[model samples]
Target: MTGAADRVYAHLGKWAPLYVWLLVVLIALGRTFYLSVNVSNSLPGKLFLVHKGAMPQLGDMAAFRHAGGGGYEAGALFLKRVVGVSGSIVTAKDAGAGFRDYFVDGRFVGRAKPVSRSGEPLKPGPDGAIPPGHYYMAADHPDSFDSRYAAVGWVAQRQIVGKAYRIF
Candidate 1:
């Protein structure tokens, strides 16, 4: 009886480390999946998680693909606040003193400069309401490249990855 018990204990000890390593690997994979499909690192400040499969609302920060990066940021993702949603009116007009003011739903939000860093003219999107299945996004940073420029105009629904929520 004692010999049988000793053999059983030896076998269990040999396999314990293997089982522990397997568990560690499984945990790593799970964490990777969570970060890849549900979190975004494109925004400044803190790491955020995106609400996958949920509808984005105005004032929500969202993660989306860069459609207007002109291949410079191919496959790059961006994070910005949703300023205008479907049926929301968005306009860009002169705000006196050579500055352009951006409006959403008839309320002032921020300014849109008329030139890019390379001295190219930055044209604004057509003034009016945002169409269905589209959105307007912006960032708090003054120099952020966002919907203020025509190149990054209205973002279509398909381009949005998910709505972001600060995690840290």
Candidate 2:
């Protein structure tokens, strides 16, 4: 009911739709830019500047360009553990084809799982070698769609936006 509140509400009402449309356009542009940048994977980081849904596709290369929250989006920045990297050997010890943890340089980093709707497992099979120029990453959560799955297969070194710094 105050003058400032009234002015704010009127301004929002007039441009809410336009603002939303602008956001959509930006997202589309970002997606396109990412697609152009990286030939594989989903957007680098989360889109919309706000993460509020299940894991998104990791194929977007531009999305990964962000190092932390200060880049473009606004959210809690997280450090992604490097479970597997280029030329690293990995093995999934399971018969049914499910998620599993990944190791790098003989150190446990994180687990690999599907982060996309395809639900495909990471390639190279158990005890396989990761090709050069590709970096495999995974989250701490088992259910997290990580490098262990195919939907997000191997994350190219060029697609890596930033190394995990610290949890905010």
lDDT per model vs. reference: 0.73, 0.46
Model 2 residue runs over 4 Å out of place are: 1-79, 95-127
**Candidate 2 minimal-lDDT segment of 10 residues:** 34-43
Backbone clashes, each candidate: 0, 17
**Candidate 1, 1-168: lDDT as tens digits:** 999999999998999899898678657655432232322332465666666555589999887777755323654677788989989988778877555888898887678777756776676655588889999988867767778777778888988877777666
Top TM-score: which candidate number? 1
Error of model 2, residue 17, in angstroms = 28
Task: Give the number of the best model, judged by lDDT.
Answer: 1
Residue 22 of candidate 1: its Cα lDDT? 60
TM-score, per-candidate, Cα-based: 0.68, 0.42
- Model 1 error, position 29 (Å): 9.1
